[model samples]
Each structure stands twice: as C-alpha cells, then as structure tokens.
Target chain A: MLDNMSLSRHISGQFNAELESIRTHVLAMGGLVEQQLTDALKAMHKQDVDLARRVIKDDHKVNAMEVAIDEACTRIIAKRQPTASDLRLVIAIIKTITDLERIGDVAESIAKVALENFTNKQYNLLVSLEALGQHAARMLHEVLDAFARMDVKAAIRVYQEDDRIDREYEAIIRQLMTYMMEDPRSIPNVLQVMWSARSIERVGDRCQNICEYIIYFVKGKDIRHTSPQEMEIFMDNNR
Target chain B: MLDNMSLSRHISGQFNAELESIRTHVLAMGGLVEQQLTDALKAMHKQDVDLARRVIKDDHKVNAMEVAIDEACTRIIAKRQPTASDLRLVIAIIKTITDLERIGDVAESIAKVALENFTNKQYNLLVSLEALGQHAARMLHEVLDAFARMDVKAAIRVYQEDDRIDREYEAIIRQLMTYMMEDPRSIPNVLQVMWSARSIERVGDRCQNICEYIIYFVKGKDIRHTSPQEMEIFMDNNR
Candidate 1:
C-alpha cells in the first residue's frame, strides 16, 4: 500500500497542486503585509493620516485571507489526508498565516501611532523608528521568502537577524525614556512611539515565529524559545 | 456503502472517544496554565522570587503540551481524516492550544516582572495589578469551562469580559503615566510595571481568542474583529 512511486506522484499531483496554490496565496498575502508595513512607516514619517487609515482598512483583507487559506488547508487535510512532510507544510502555512495577520495588525498599530503626531516633534526619534521599521519590513520579506522556498538556512538567517532588531528596539526605547524624563509634556507622544516600537518588536517576534515554523515544517523540530546562539547550535546538530 | 447507522455509530463511538481524550488533555493543560497565572500573580504581589522562578520553569511543560496536542491533531487528521464538525473541533483545538501556550508565556513575563522587584517600590500598582490578575484569572477559568462544554453563549460572555479588562488596563496605564510624570526617578520600575500590564492585557487578548475559537467551533461562525454590540446582534441572529 505504501508505494513510493504512488506517494511521490501523490505529492506532486493533486494534493500538492492545491498546496502549491495555497502557498502562492500565502506569498501574495505576505507581499501585502510587507506593503502595509512600508506604507505604515511612510505614513508615520510623513504624517499622512490618510495612508494610516488605509493601512488599518486593508487589514480586513489580510484577515479574510487567513480564514480562506485555513479553510482550504482544512479541506485538503480532510480530502487528501496529506501525511508527514506534506502535512507539516500545510500546518506551517496555517501557523505562518496567523503571524502574517499579526504583522498586519502591528502595521495598523504603527499607523495609529502616526495619527498621534499632534505636536509634530522629535525628528530624530522618527528617523530612528523609520530605520527600525525598514529593518522589520526587510526581515519580514526575507522570512516570507524563506517560507516560500522552505529554506531552512534562510529561516535561520532571519532568526539570527532578530537580535539586531531587538537591540535597535531597546535603544529606541531608551531614547524615548530619556525624552519622557526630560520633558513630561512629551509623555503622551513618547508613549505612542514606545508602544509602536513595542509593536515592531512584536513584528520581529512574529518573523522569528514564521522562521521557526519553517524549520519545523522542513525539519520536524521545534526550535521556539531557544536563544539565537542555541538555535544555531540546534540547527547545526539537526541539519 | 454509505450506511447511516454505521456512520452514526462511528460518530458516537471511536471518533468521539478519541475526541474526548484530547479534550481532557486540553483541559488538563488549561488547568496548568491557570495555576501558572495564579502563581505568577502571587509571586508579583507577594514578591516571591522563588515562585516566579517556578512559573518560568513551568512554561516548558506548557510548551510541551502544545506540541503534543498538535501532533495528536495531525495524527487524527492523517488517520481518521475527520470531516465537518469533527474536523473543526480538531482544528480549533490546535488554534486554542497556541493561545494557551502564549498565556503561559504571558505568565512567565509577569513572573519576570516580579523578579524586577529590586528596589521594592510601587505597592499600590502591584495591588492594582493583582486585582487585574484575579479578574483575568477568573476570565480564563470561565473561558476554559465554556470551551470544555462547547458553550457558545458562555464563550461569548467571556469575549464580552475582555472589554472590561481593556478598560481596567487603560486606567492603570493612565495612573502609571502620571506616576512617571511626577516621580522621574521611578521611571525604570514604572516601565517594568507597564510592560507587565501590557502582558496581562495580552493575556486577556489570548483568552478572547480562545473564546472566539470555541464559538467558531460550536457555531461555525467567525465573529472576530466585530464590535461587541455587533457580536451580540450576530450571535442572536445566528443562534
């Protein structure tokens, strides 16, 4: 019953055809999330409330994509009963889509932060935040690329990139803290930036999550909660 | 070939048996997560570093439970190839366990906040946090009960409770903001408390997620992103 040729054919045939289509859909959605992140950052840097609102409004489409993709995966599992690697692929897509949707959420949060620029102050912090935003966006794009290719090493690269993001985020937070301590009047504005920075850190975490799911799907290992250095070790040993 | 009686027996017998076992497992995991939250709050309120450390240590077990349940779901999908409501139950369990694990993570975050009790200041905020923690604890317990019974109305009740938690969280944030503005020296401690409160707010979010999944499982409707008032209207019409 476990015919190798038949199994191979099954993988490349109908089940994978559907899987491939879902994969394409997920990648397309990932492209949308990246654009949302970029646009949200642009909105903040330029104080474009209209673009911020657009980012918030576009999140519904991202949310809808998740539901649709999840339904397709469920249908595939019920119908095709994909096993082992194929099953992992489907599950990874499901998990990654959740992260992608959350990325969209983080973008919306940043957009709201953009709307809070009542004083139009702190160009330095805004530039720093833009740098953080660009880094997060690029990391997200890479991780999505890794997922689309099932690239384990690329996933690890994204995993390693998170530490840099974390450091940059904390530095921004420290600067914001100094701002708040010096001028109590800027507390509300600084608080919004701090919250937005927190959201970007969450984006890094989500990107890390997507990377972890990729390795899990490809290698069947759970590397979550591992330190970046330990992740390197684990990947080395597992690979 | 499509024998109704056999299919009926199949639904109520072996498949249901496996389903019951997984449900029990999930509930056991929920109980552990609830204990983790309570212990973390105790650690913070009473300044029990040892207990906080224990909470952090216990998260590994929660993570293990998530992996085990996910594997079981994958096995059931691969072997039983469950359809319709049965399939939705497994998928929802998979989704719910991720939220449960994240709740565990939040508890760990709170425990770490307790460990930050170096100068031992902010007793009032700590007490307020305990009240918020207790409310979140009760909400978590009720949501799990709703989940176990697949009670959509009970789940909706829990969903509605998160708004109260959010309001409480915002009020606390405002109080903390004033503290930071008045006593600049307390910024570090205040920042830790703010982070901890954010984690607790996220716990509320994760609980709301679990409730939504329960309703989705029982009623097969997506009420996420809908306003609470709109949710009530949708539930009444859909129910």
Candidate 2:
C-alpha cells in the first residue's frame, strides 16, 4: 500500500508538471499572437506589404500552437481527472486558448485588409487605429500577466481599461464618417480601415474575455454580463 | 467490490446524462438566439419597434441561458472526469456556447441599431438589407442544423452559402454609398442600416464557426483556415 501511494503521488506530480508546461506554452502562444497584432497594425500604418505578408505567414504558427495547446489540454483532462480549482484552471486554459486563436485570426484579418489597401494613398486614420491597437495589445498583455500571476487585481484593471478601447473605437468611426463625407475618394480605404478598427475592437473584447476567465479561475465567480460597477464591487469583496 | 463497481458505473452514467443535458440546453439557447436574430431583422425590415424591443428584452434570457449552460459545463467537468469523445463534446459545447452567446449580442446590437433608426422616415435602403437579412438568417439556421445533425455535408453548405451573403453585403454597401452620395439626407439612417448589414454579415461568419466546430466534433478534423477544396475533402472522407 505504501508503494501504491508513492506511485500515485508520482503520477500526480507528473500531471502537475504537464499543467505547468501547458501554462507556459499558452503564454508563449499569447506572446506570438500579440506580436502578430502589433506587427499587422504597424504594417498597415507604414504601408509595408512585406511585413503584412509576414504577419499572414505567422498565422500558421498561431494555428499550429492552437492545435497543440488544444491537444495538450485534452490529454491533461483525460489523463488527470483534476478536480475543483485544478479542473477549472485546465478548462479556463482551454477556453482562453480559443480566444487567443481567434485573436490571431483577427490579426490575420487586419493584415489581409492592409494587403488589399496597400496601394491606396496614406491617411490619418492610422493614427487613431494605432492608438486602439496599442491599447488592445496592452490589455492582452495584462490579461496574460494576470493569468501568469493569478492576480485578480490586474485582471480587473484589464476589464476597466476596455472602456478606453471602446471610446477610441467610437472616435475612429466618427472620424471615418467625417472623412468619407468630405472626400468620397477615401471611402474604400477608409471603410477598410474602419473594418480593421472594428476587428481590433473585437480583439479588445476577447482580451476582456481572457480577463473574465482569470477572474473565474481566481474566485470561481461568473462575472460575465454583469455591469462594470458590479464587477468592481464583486472583485473588491472577493479580493 | 460489487458496490464499488456499481458506484463507478453510476458516476459514469451521470456524466453521460449531464453531457446530454448540456447539449440539450445549448440547443435550446441556440434556438432562442437564432430567433432573436431573425426577429431583430424582421423588426428592422417591417419597422416594428415593439418587436425590436422584444428582441432586446429576450437578450436577458439568452444571457441567463449562457450562464446556466456554462455552470452546467463546469459542474460536469468538476464532478465527473469524462474521457475521449465525451471530453471533446464537453469542450466543444463550451466553445460553441461562447459563439452562441456572442451571436446573441450581435442580435442585440442589430436590434439597438434598428430601434435607434426607427424614427427616421427613410425606407429605401431596406430592400437589399431585407434580402441580406433573409440570407443571413437562413445561413444561421442551416448552420445550427448542421451542428445538431452533425452533418459535415450540411456544414460545407454553410461555406458555399457564405459567398452569397458576402455578395449581398457588398452590394448593400455599394448601394448605400450611392444613396449617401446622391443625397445627404439619407446618410444617418442609411449608415445605421449599413451597420445592421455588417452585423448580419458577421452573424453569418459566426455560423461558419459553428459549422467548423461541427466538423471538428464529427470528423475529428480542424477545418479552420483551410482552403475550401481541403474542407471538401475532409467532409468527403469523414462523411
């Protein structure tokens, strides 16, 4: 019986090691995806088709990472029968990876848009778009940080920061409308830029989703669809 | 030993039953969200503010259902450590519910835009938009059908139909651009309508996601980001 107990402990340790590996792999994948978005936006702003194509090429790596992460998650779930917080952590990792994979797709979408509109004349839309991209990239980074640290406070901060992105998105839309009204010649490229902004706005929303998962992992609470004020209060009480 | 064996069997049975319940709950939620999208479109085309408000109100139910399904998933994952296909089913349900919930939000967004533009007297943009909505609503319905039936063939139908939505979406954008150019008075309402079209187009894309998930579940293949010809081979081989 003592030998059996030792063997069971050894197996449990193996699972724990695998979980840690999964976490590391996911963060690495997140870093790659975040870089994809940054480079895509920079490509668009600088009108660099080569950089845009590079981002597009990098998407396959993101896709491969997603599949690997997913397989690792499934293996962990099947092999380890983890319970409670351990189970939630694995499941959250699975869900968060899905969001990250989709964010990578958004980056690819932005890159594709940039590629299509590369021949068009430059415009001021990139300024607001760069701001939005920067804000969203920061949110993703913070969420990943929160996950790494299990810092609910940092996750909450990411949640609160989403409003900045929303406001910036709205401002860009308004600015695009005015530009389109003044010069119809800018309509095609302006519309592409608007769609790209919308895509990045969605990227920000997905970041908030990652934050939500972190909160779930930390507190076992379902803060989704709850108001920001209520979330703040809940976070305070839980913390 | 007999009791232990029976207990293990009972737990396994409970796991299977809970998974069935999760699937049923997701289907019900999908039905409600699909209706919300359809009615939101109908409300916009017919200028039915009451119907639009109803869609908005129904959003609360969709949100509640999402929470309920998520809770169910978490409980199952926590209590019963399912294996293999069962694990995939649970994970797919979780991811699919996220997509379904987001679809509900898109429906709500469409309803909000519809309600806000209700005061405008202009109605000319409704022609192509109505067509776009019909196509999108049909695509969503078919995609869900593909999901429920696990019909890889039917899922491929979604990708084939997407080009139709794209064509209609582009046509509507072009028509709206001409309308805005010809008369500034129609700009605001037409823009709102354009926004609605864009939302519907995105809803179609989400339907594509559902189909892709179905393929993954049924055929054990990741069809995402793959070429159409490759997907056809996947469906052909898997079917």
Candidate 3:
C-alpha cells in the first residue's frame, strides 16, 4: 500500500510537470502573437508592406502553436485526469488558449487590411490607429502577465481597461465617418482603417476574455459580461 | 458482484441524467436569448416601449439561466469526473453558455438603444431595420437548432448564412451615413438605428462562435479562426 501511494504521488508530480510545459509553450505562443500585432500596426503606420508580409507569414507559426498546444492539452487530460483545482486550471488554459489563438487571427486580419491599403494613398488618420494598437498591445501583455501569475486583481484591472479600447474604437469610427463625409476619395482607405480598428478592438476584447480566464483560475468564477463594478464587489467578497 | 455492478450502473445512469439536464437547460437558455433579440428589434420597429421593457426584463432571466447552467456544469464536472467524450461535452457546454449569455447582453444593449430613441423623433427607416432584425433572429434560431440537435451539417449552413447579416449591416451603415449627410435632422435617430444595427451584427458574430462550439463538440477539433472551406473539408474527412 505504501509503495502504491508513492507511485501515485510520482504520477501526480509528472502531470504537474506536463501542465507547466504546456503553459510554457502557450506563453511563447502569446509572445509571438503580440509581436505580430505590434509589427502589423507599425507596418500600417509606416506603410511598410514588408512588415505586413512578415505578420501574414507568422500566422502559420501561430496556427502551428495552436495545434501543438491543443494536442498537449488533450494528452494531459486523457492521461492525468487531473482533479479539483488541477482540473479547473487545465480547463481554463484550454479555453484561454483558444481565445489567444483567435487573437492571433485578428492580428492576421489587421495585417491583411494593412497589406490591402499599402498601395492606396496613406491616411493621416493612421496616427490615431497607432494609439489604439499600442493600447491593445499593452493590455494584451498585462493580461498575459495576470494569467501567468494568476493575479485576480491584475485581471480585474485589465477588464476595467476594456472600456478604454471601446472608447478608442468609437472615436476612430466617428473620425472615419467624418473623413468619409468630408471626402469621398478617402472612403475606401478609411474603411480599411475602420476594419483595422475593429480588429484591434477585438484583440482587446479577447484580452479581456483571457483576463476572465485568469479570474476563473484564481477565483473559480466566471465574471464575463458583468460590469466592472460588480466584478470588484464580487471579487472583494470572494477574496 | 451483483451489488457492485448495480452500484456502478446507477452512478453511470446519474451521469447520463446530468448530461441530459445540462443539454436541456442550455437549449432553453438559447431560446430565451434568441427571443429577446427578436422582440427587442421588433420593439424598436414599432416604437413599443412595453416590448422593449419586456426584453430588458427577460435579460435578467437569461442571466439567471446562465448561472443555473454554469452551476450545474460545475456540479456535474466535480461529482462525476467525466472522461473522454463526456468531459469534452461538459467543457463545450460551459463555453457555449458564456457565448449565449453574451448574445443576451448584446440584445439588452440594442433594447437600451431602442428605449433611448423612443422619446425622440421617429424615423421611418424602421422598415429596413425590421428586415435586418428578422434576418438575424432567423439566423439565431437556426443556429440554436443546429446546436441542440448536434447537426454538424446544419451548423455549417448557419455558418454560411452569417455573411448575409454582415452584408446587411454594412449596407445599413452606408444608408444611415448617406441619410445623415443629406439631412442633419435625421442624424440622432439614424445614429441610434445604426448602433442597433451594429449590435445585431455582433449578435451574428456570436452565433458563429456558437457554431464553432458546435463543431468542437461534435468533431473534437478547433475550427475557430480557421477557414470555413477548410473546416468543411475537415468535417468531410473526419466524418
């Protein structure tokens, strides 16, 4: 009986090691995705088709990472059958990785928009978009940090910042409308920028989704779509 | 040996019952959310504050349903320790409920916009708006059916129809912009209508997310952010 208990403990330790390995791969994937978004936005601002092409090419890496991480998760779940907190952590990571992978897709969408507008007349409006992209990238980094650390407080802060991206998105839309109304010649170009802004806003939303996963991992509750105020109150009571 | 076998069968039976209950609750929640979107759009068309209020009130019920379903999932996952396909089904249902709840929130946002514009001047643009709403409502209904029935082929059809809502949303935005440009008096009401249209477009996007979840549940592959054509090929090959 003693030997059997010792062997089970050893297996549980191996499962934790496997889970950590998967987490490491996911974080590396997140880093590549963040770079893709950043470079894509910068490419748009500078009208550098080369950087845009790089982003488009890097999506394959993201896709490959997604497949590997997914396979790792499946094997872990099937082999380890982790329970309780371990189970929740694995589940949260699986769902959160999917969201992260989708964020990479949006980044690819932004790169496509940038590439499409490369030959068009450059919009002076791309400057404001740089701001939106920067904010989104910063949020993504913070949310990933929150996820890695399992910091519910940090995740809560990132969730609060989603409204900032929404405000930026609305501002961009109104500005694009103003430009389109002022000059029909700029309509197509502005429309491309609108799609790009929408993509960035989507990235921010997915970052918030990641933060929600962090809350779930740490607190074991889903606080998505609820108001930030309510989240704070609930987090306070729960903690 | 007979008693042990009977106890094991009884536990397995309980697991199946819990799975059925989860499926039933999710479908019921999906129906409630779909109805909220339809009624909110209808209320906007008819300028019926009463209907709008009902949609708003029903959002609370959707929230309650989401909580009930999530708790059920938590209890089932904890008590049953489901493995293999059963584990996947539970995780997929948990994620799908989150998507459904977000759809409910989007409907509430539309209803709130409807209420805001009720006291203001009326716009006759509600006819096209009503058509757009009906299209979206139908799409939601079909997708929900595909989900409940686990009909992957039917779910793929819903995925194909999502573009229709996207095109309608773009057209409405352009029409509203043209109206605002031609007549400043139409700006406020038309803008609210545009906001509602955008919300409806997001609802369509959420439906696509649900379809992706359906594919995940049925096929055990993540097709999200992948090309639809490729997904169709995958479904063919795997099936």
Candidate 4:
C-alpha cells in the first residue's frame, strides 16, 4: 500500500520534474557531442585511427541519449497536457534534440574523415581544421549554456559565431581546391579533408539551430527565418 | 459577435479538425518540397541558371509554410489539450515539418549547385543526378501518401527505396571521383556537383525519417533507431 502510494506521488511530481530531467539529458548529450568533436579533432591532428574508431562507436551513445530525451518529452506531454511555457519547453526540447543529434552525426562524419587521413600523407591544413573545430565546439558549448539559462543575449552571441566558422570554412575549401589543383596525387585525401571541413561547417549550423530553439523557448517566437538584423534587435529587446 | 462566435466554434472543433488541417498543411508543404526538388533537378538538366535562381528564391515559400504549420500545431495543442492519438498526431506533425523544412534546405542547396555548374563546363552527371532526385522525390511523394492513408505497408516499401538511392549516390560519387582524377581542371565544378549529390543522398535520409514518423503514428512506437530487420519484423507482425 505504501509503495503504491509513493509510485502515484512520483507520477504526480513528474509534471514539474520532467522538464528539469530533460534539460539534464540535453546537457549530458551536449557534453558528449562537444567531447566527441574534441576527440575527433585530436584524432585528426594526431592521425590516431584508434581514437577515430572510438568516436565512431561512441556515436551510438549520443543516439541513445536523443531517444531517452524524446521519450521523456513525449511522456510529459501525454500525461500532463502541459500548456503555455511547459508546452513550449517540451516542443523546444524536441527541436533541440534533433539539432543535438545532427551535431553527433557531424562529429561521427568528422571521425570517419579522421580515419581516412591515416592512410596517406595529406596537406597541412589540420591547423585550420582544428581552429574551425574549436570555434564550433565553443559555439555549441556557449549555446547550450545559454539554453540552460534561457539567456537570449548569450544565444544571440552564439549565432554570430557561425559567421566566423563560415569564413574559416571557405578559406579551407579554397586551400583544398588549390592543393587539389596542384597535386593530382592528393585528390582522394584532399577530398576527405574537404568533407571533414564541410562537416565542421555543418556543426556551426547545428549550433545556430540550437540557439534558435533557445530564442524560441524564451521568447515564444520562431526566429529561424528572421533576418540577422531583426534577430539581433529581437534578442536585444528580449534581453 | 458572429465573428467571435464562429472563431470560438472553430477552436472548439479543432480536436478532430486540427489533425486534418495540419495534414492538409503537411501535404501542401510536401507538394511544394516535391516541386522544389523537381525544379532544382530540372534546372540542373537544362543548366537554366534563371530557373535555378527562381528555385532558390521560391524556397522562402516552403519556409513560410513550415512556420504557418508550426504555429497551427502549437495553437492546437495549447487550446485543445488534445489527448491520446490527437496529441501523438500533433507531435508527429511537428517532427514531420522539421524533415520537410530540411528537404527545402536540400533543394535550395541543389539550386545553388545548379547555379555553380553554369560558371564553367563540368562532367555530365546530371542524368544520373536527375534520376536520383526523381527517386527521392518519388520516395517522398509515396511516403506522404502512406502517411495520409496511415498505410504501414506502403511506408515500409518507401523505406526500402532508400537503399536504392544510397547505391545510386555511391555510384555517382565514384563517377565524379573518376572524372576528377582524369581532369584536374574540373576540380571546382566537380566539387559543386559532389555537394549536390551529397544533398540528394541526404534527401533519401529525410524520406526514411518521414516513414519512421508514419510508423510512429500508426503503431504508437518510435522505430527511428530500430534495425531494419527488426523494423520489418515488427511491421509485418503489426500488419
């Protein structure tokens, strides 16, 4: 009789507890993604094929985290029939998980590229790629922090970081193109590096996506397609 | 008073009609996505830069549709507090629209590649690319069809088509690599084509995502991470 009573009380508390629990999962997953990117970048820098393989294998954990979070969000919505901010939070978590999952995918792709760079000597663009990875990982970390705090201004700052990553991505692409043009022998390896660079660029996009959700969660607005200037203004006003 | 009365009535009827209305929006958005991919593919074939540019610009319409549908879903959930299948349907629609928006992004990316190809002559892989796009677009069309009817069998068949698209994508990538090796001068153009091919391959992924949602809606289960063999068995038994 006591166990049944406690179980029912636990279910009752779930309405308030679920959001905080989901946020915990999101942060845990964010930490894993950030670590995955860091490890992948290190693997690429050192050409450690073993570390690269581990990153690839560890992606399953990230996938599992997403499912756990999604199921949590779904369960909360079903039982609570949550409205207003609770509803928005559940919806935003769903969106945030998708972005987080995509970041894991990108990290996995980068790890594969890291594996490829082991086979042959490639250009010395690892420095640039490492810089790009750091920028993206920091952006992701900052965005997740902003999300936790529901800080619109902090999320807006993360959005601007995408531009820096984009510029770096373009520069790396140009360098890859030049290298490919000059050395036909390096085409395959260069192609792999191009893909890795592209994946890093996509990480920037995932960061932007997370920041957008943070804005949505706080402001009750979808600013994904908004102009940059407008987004900035809205963020400032909300802050 | 009449307007207010009718609006309240509409909100009250939203429990059943909301799902149907969201379905209409989804199909409308799917139709536009299908059209965008078709036009983007067509632009690649004709090398019609003008048509490609138009496709790029037209992507905003798809984005707008996403926001509109999203708002509708949010409004329904908040006002109706729908339970059971109605809640699941609303949540699934939210997921589906994300995939649809991604399709729009991919289509826009393809259009940009189509624009790039016109800068200088490149390898002639458009025929294969067009075939891949058609397969993806068809898969998308069929999945949306299955979704509308809640036909698990049809959705399974659409899921299987992803294997065909992946194979075609690999074959095209090989062809592009061969072309790149033979002619270093074509590096830039070939890279753009490669990006476009990669985007098409991702479309196949988005199709599978939609099919997963269909199964979720029908079976009240999330099979997104399920192994194909298990998914098949579950679907067969469920059927």
Best by lDDT: 1
Candidate ranking under DockQ, highest first, comes to: 1, 4, 2, 3
Please provide, for model 4 over A93-154, each residue's C-alpha lDDT reduced to its tens digit, 9 standing for 90 to 100: 89998888888888888888776633334637565588888888888889888876777778
B59-110 per-residue lDDT for model 2 (tens digits): 9899899988988987887688777666766777777888898889888887
Give lDDT tens digits, candidate 1, residues B112-166: 8888754645766787788788989999999999887777777778887989999
**Residue pairs of candidate 2 with colliding backbone atoms:** none
TM-score of each: 0.92, 0.90, 0.84, 0.91
lDDT of each: 0.84, 0.79, 0.76, 0.81
lDDT value, residue A10 of candidate 3: 33
CA RMSD per model (angstroms): 4.0, 5.7, 5.9, 6.6
What lDDT tens digits, residue by residue, belong to model 4 across residues B1-239? 22223224434453667667788889999999989988888888888799899999999899899999998988888888776566777788899989999999998888887776343346366665888888888888898887767677787888888999999999999888888888888888888888889899998999899888877766678887766697778868754
Tens digits of per-residue lDDT, candidate 2, A198-235, equal: 88998888988888888787677878988668876887
Chain B TM-score per candidate, please.
0.91, 0.88, 0.88, 0.90
Chain A TM-score compared with the true chain A, each model in order: 0.91, 0.90, 0.89, 0.90
Which candidate number has the best DockQ? 1
Give stretches of model 1 more than 4 Å off: A1-12, A225-230, A237-239, B1-12, B118-121, B226-230
- Please say which candidate is ahead in DockQ: 1 or 2: 1
Could you say which candidate leads in TM-score?
Answer: 1
Candidate 1 chain B least-lDDT 10 residues: B1-10
lDDT tens per residue, model 3, B1-239 = 22223223334576887787788899999989988888888777777789988898888789888878877876776677676666667777877887788889878877787676533334576666787788888989999998777776777788878899999988987886666667555555665676678778877888888887777766677786567688768757644
Scored against the true structure, residue B23 in model 1 reaches a CA lDDT of 79
Q: Give the lDDT ranking, best first.
A: 1, 4, 2, 3
